[model samples]
Target chain A: MRLFDFFKLSRRGPTSADTAKQRLQVLVALDRKGGGGPDFLPLMQKELLEVIRKYVEIEEERVNVDFQAGTGFSTLEVNIELPSETAKMAV
Target chain B: MRLFDFFKLSRRGPTSADTAKQRLQVLVALDRKGGGGPDFLPLMQKELLEVIRKYVEIEEERVNVDFQAGTGFSTLEVNIELPSETAKMAV
Candidate 1:
């Protein structure tokens, strides 16, 4: 093995389990926030897009909205990606 | 009026309603994640603290856990604040 391989082997980088946990956590939050309706997401996305456009440019795909369900509540997660610094400055 | 006062007046910063919306979103997400049990929160908090302590030192108050309920699901929101760069590097 290469010298760097040792570090790679010893160091535990983020695993799929970690990603799954994060996704589940966000999903559960979204589910509990009354997010099951089909139209709600699209409508909310459109409105948010408009509001954000006023400040910075963002693509539709960059805006993610989802919901999750748990024992007693739901969660709605809204992840919006911002433009790069140069892009923002130019806008 | 000061020059900055005009900007402050015209520029609409985040209002209480925006905060409320954000809170409600997170709450709904948490509620849907089956976060209603009082015992669950403390137990989860303890375990999480143990895990995070291995990587970085964090105050108990910096970690916030909550839940919210909605139409068909619940959400569990876990917010953990990390130590500053200098602090982490020192560790």
Candidate 2:
């Protein structure tokens, strides 16, 4: 199923998943830029913060980025908590 | 928008993105495991592959995992083609 389908099937509804998914989509598109390097987590972290700052005011300490390698696949996770008041507007 | 909301607002249907979103969501959850680390791209890549392998067959070369840091946010993208045919069924 596509993310939309999952949303339709979801008991929680798509509106709820939108923010997270939007963030994820943007994140994934950027991560695909790596070209045969050790890993771009550090670079990604730096650049990601730069991008977010351009669009939104944020707290530097709250942003995070990482890669997790699994047996069949690997995952990258980026966590960000904008200023509480800002997050509410985003919500 | 949440993932589900994006699906509804999407120009293309979520069914197509479902495979990608499902993959990304799984990847993100896994990536959240890192704690005070240099970067877990390698470990995330390994563990992700292992998890995918347990459920489905895949081409090792096709699987990708990385972190992309932006100004305010960062993202991880994992791309995997599950043996072509398997990807179809998942669809």
Candidate 3:
């Protein structure tokens, strides 16, 4: 692979920008594929909480989800605070 | 519904925090369910790109996806720039 390409792959971890992109990607994927049914968002919200609960402790109320528009693409954003020291340490 | 609950639902929009939260949820969903094999990330990246492309114009190279660890939870982030004025106006 080219040097720049290799560098890009190697650098693919937690960065503010990268995190933002991933969030947007997931949101759009769900919005388009999840179907905007009445229960869809709630189901997504429930499923999201369930999935997150497996990996990290979170404040159920503090959790937030949204959709955003940039220059051309729209993003779905998810944010939650971790609940454990061990979880942070594992990362 | 209680006033607090009503406010929460009514206020939900393209807020930055909400967007971030959605991103994290989607990423985790994919990571846990996407089965991170050699092709997983690439497939996710491809699928993400495809989904985003349907609704917005993006800077292909500038597009980014990442994963992050917060207090206890981890997040997947996706970021992309829109290519057309129409996409932003539609939001």
- All candidates: interface RMSD: 23.4, 15.2, 15.0
True contacts kept of each: 0.03, 0.01, 0.03
Q: In candidate 3, what are the lDDT values of residues A1-63, reduced to their tens digit? A: 121222233233665533432221123322222222121333344444454354344566646
Per-residue error for B29 in candidate 1, Å, reads 16
Q: Cα lDDT for residue B25, model 1?
A: 21
State candidate 1's DockQ. 0.03
Task: Please give, as one word, the docking class of candidate 3.
Answer: incorrect
Error of 3 at B6 (Å): 20
lDDT of 2 by residue, B1-91 (tens): 2432332343234355333432322323211111222322333444444544544455666666555543333334456543322322121
lDDT of 2 at A54: 44
- Residues forming the 10-long window of minimal summed lDDT in candidate 1 chain A: A23-32
For all predicted structures, in order, the TM-scores are: 0.26, 0.31, 0.29
The local lDDT score (0 to 100) that residue A20 gets in candidate 1 is: 23
Model 1: per-residue Cα lDDT over B1-91, one tens digit each: 1212221232236554332221112111211122222222223334433433443445666667664434423344455443332122112
CAPRI band for model 1: incorrect
Better of 1 and 2 by TM-score: 2
Runs in model 3 with CA error above 4 Å? A1-25, A28-91, B1-42, B67-75, B83-91
